[model samples]
Target: MLKSGFGPKALLSFACLMAPLSALAQDATSSSPATNEVIGLRANLSPADVRGPLNYEPTKGPLESFFPDCSVDKQMASELSEAFGEALISFDPENKEVRFGVAYKGLSGNAIMAHFHDGAPGVNGPVLQTICGHPPPTSAIGVSATAVMGDKCPVGNHGVLSGTWQLTDHDCPEGSDKSCISRTVDEQVQLLACGNLYVNIHTCLNQPGEVAGQITPVNWIGKEQNCNALPPKSSQ
Candidate 1:
């Protein structure tokens, strides 16, 4: 005789359980037609062409006091003759990310901090993001000549002369005012495109800003490209 729990009702229940399993197996083996949803869609509709490597030269003139009492001295400014450096910004609008590599030498004192500040040319503004050198736990300097890139600060001992910053994490200023930071990567991209962003390096000698440079694009001919001269890209 058939088992007590293995009668018609049990067979029906087993069949029911196997139906979905069979369907799942068919689905696992079958190939569906590819969808065309994103096949021809352009990643960035804006023709601003702001996505590329940018160059900057940090000097003394862009320095501005963040504190009322700590102004950069003219004599100290004159002494930054050997304290020159270059910064490179690589922006990826589609990915909503930015990569920065900055290097400097011959600072008046130990490097303390570096940042990308939001401000117009020749004007001082609040720190929009810290690139490196917020010490105690974190090193005040990064490795010299070594390049790092990512959405966060690189791991391990970075020298005091060079470093990188990724815009994905720690891309905002340390303040209550939301206005001090860009709300979106697109906005930051716009700020960069319009020449509204700059890099600042702070030292123990000059807490405000020791060396600063307005970030700007470099053309194919190795010349600075003025963002204002380019016509606005057609809105998407």
Candidate 2:
């Protein structure tokens, strides 16, 4: 037998009381809007952060093989640690559009390509987005019209990586290797919010990757010499 207190009126009141609490819980769990702006400061990325026994040579497949490494080429990454770079990324969770502006210099060799990967600061992850130096055909697979991956990069040791990455899915594509992975826009945003995404710039000398930086969300205000800002000219 149902108790009197469990009547429709009492049940309705109980539900009414819980509704507000449920709404409050949802409000607490929702992400803040300010989390959309992400930044990264890279300095001489090292293989110590990579995970694998591939001997610094990518072994994914035909696609990854395009990024070939020479056993005899000078491993400039060993000293490129002195190199510096930074990236400003704007991510819109609603549209899954990612815009990136990056400046890197002092690389040991020419900037071959750049990408965004999934990994922690001290770990290595698969490349989910290509920022530049991609072939024209494959570049359009998940690229945006605002920028072209095949566009020429800056001439010299300094290179600027600018492009848009339209994440498709997080699943690993067939015929691809660990170096490359697929991620949907939602997964990308979640990773950005979790601070698990990083940008990597690969060079001819260090095909494995020369300079890499972990992407983080932050406010650029009150930050001096930020974004790899050059030091002021010394007094003559």
Candidate 3:
């Protein structure tokens, strides 16, 4: 990744590194570029992409201290597994913030929380930021994470969450306990451009996630993003 205020040589290298970035797209993605005018990332949440975190069995910390497992009944599991959702993300270079919105339906229970996690396509990273930031006592109120944040998201089998993640002294958005990927907003945008960010929706039935999707840049979105917030090439 190009560091802030990098020189021309670094810019060239950054361009080269981005040449094959479309390789990041999964087979499910479209071969066609988006027809509309837009630059951002999109995630298609589904159960097939759902993966439980790596768990090692052996004497260690309390076994109870674990992520919610697939303990939902088979019938409900089948239905919830069919749940799907989407998350849209983009960055504002001027303000140094990440703007995102999430909508999902068919959850077995009300969403407990929703977060932006960092990791490779099939890997699991800790919560990078909380787009809908809610936890424990607050989440236990049985409302959607959006509602906990004072947003007007309807509850039940469907829900929506939206917020801006801006650079601040705190690791995460205020009121969240999740670990942040970076305190710098630029780094967070870099993560999105690199397809390292994902949205995960949590429910009491699926504590880790009821549905989730890897955030992928739309068309040349990532490749074209001036994440370094640099001036135009002509100006340089």
TM-scores for all candidates?
0.45, 0.56, 0.57
Candidate 3 per-residue lDDT, tens place, 145-220, comes to 2332332123455655555565442244343323223335555656666677678777656666778898887644
Candidate 2 to truth, TM: 0.56
Q: Tens-digit lDDT track for model 1 on 74-100?
A: 334344434655454444434444444
- The residue ranges of model 1 lying beyond 4 angstroms of the native Cα positions read 1-81, 135-182, 220-236
lDDT of 2 by residue, 120-225 (tens): 5566666565565643233212222222355333445664555456555656545453344455555555566566667777666665567677766552221322
The TM-score ranking, best first, is 3, 2, 1
lDDT of all predictions, in order shown? 0.39, 0.49, 0.51
lDDT leader: 3
How well does candidate 3 match the true structure, expressed as C-alpha RMSD? Answer: 14.4
Clashing pairs in 1: 142-158, 142-159, 143-158, 143-159
Q: Model 2's lDDT to the true fold?
A: 0.49
- Ten contiguous residues minimizing lDDT sum, candidate 1: 36-45
